[model samples]
Target: MANPSHDRDPGLVLGFERTVGDEVQAVARSAGLVVDVVLWMLRRGGWSVGIGCGAVDEPMPASPREAAGPAFVLAREAVEAAKSRQRMVPLAVRGSDEGAALDAEAVLMLVAATGARRSAAGWEAVDAVEEAGGTRQEDVAARLGISQQAVSQRLRTALYDETRAATRAATHLLTTAHP
Candidate 1:
């Protein structure tokens, strides 16, 4: 489901709901939505995510599972690839443009790997900034009960800006390869 929603990019997830057991099905029409979904799954952990970008039949279906097209077929294949053994990154992207798909996957994996190495305190600082919606560092420091310098240090060490840039790149790549 579209759980753990965020306001940092509300438009990325304006109206999404998922109701499934042991799994969830979703469709993202834009690059931002795709990246938002990927971030959500990564944060929750324990998900083998597949992002399929391509053409779907006209007239959207009631449910994602009921939808059909190259996108669906690519997504199935991507999921299988994600679940493969020795997969360092638990996500995959398959699209009409093979080059873009590979680029998107590489960039997303970098973001994921960087996130995985963040410490609890680092996440605390990062989340404070993200939740505040372009808030000042001092504000984040006050919220986290840490010194402003500490907040800066944490964000720096976390490579928050770098990761954010990487995420944006991934979104663009996905959009090109899929849409």
Candidate 2:
């Protein structure tokens, strides 16, 4: 909505609100969903995912339309910045703490780019293992009708461990960015 003040939603969807600049704005109660949203958006492809973290107006309302703060402003900036990037991963982070925000963005972009390079076969192995729980490479291999060695090879090629580690680091950075 170009004028968010005039528009109101009956209910929030996925902890975000449809707002101006084509933003699904996440506010206080919905804040915890940011990392999950980013991870899911990256896997789905074709989205410029931006995260903003910082102080919100005291006693924030349930609706994003009713909320106004630096966090919302930063989110707009982050998404606009993400959209402007040409050949890079469509992801960004912005926060009251600039350094932590940059660190978060760096880690997230590295992990996203690395995952982007993963092959379809590699994703299959990754999916299977994830579905079966991280402990069972054999289960993943059997489900995918590939050898355990092949499953391991695919994960190695995909750098799954590195991605997970980077994701954790990014999440941590995001948390530190605001509070």
Per-residue alpha-carbon lDDT of candidate 2 for residues 17-82, written as tens digits (9 for 90 to 100): 676665666553333345555766776777887787877786867777777788878887898889
Clash count of each predicted structure: 0, 0
76-110, model 1: which lDDT tens digit per residue? 88877887846656888899999999899999988
Error of 1 at 47 (Å): 0.4
Candidate 1: lDDT over CA atoms? 0.79
Kindly report which residue pairs in candidate 2 clash with one another. Answer: none
Q: Give residue 170's error in model 1 in angstroms.
A: 0.4
Q: What is the TM-score of each candidate against the true structure?
A: 0.88, 0.84
Q: Could you tell me which residue pairs clash in candidate 1?
A: none
Best TM-score among the predictions, by candidate number: 1
lDDT of each: 0.79, 0.74
Superposed by TM-score, candidate 2 places the C-alpha of residue 37 at a distance from the truth, in angstroms, of: 1.5
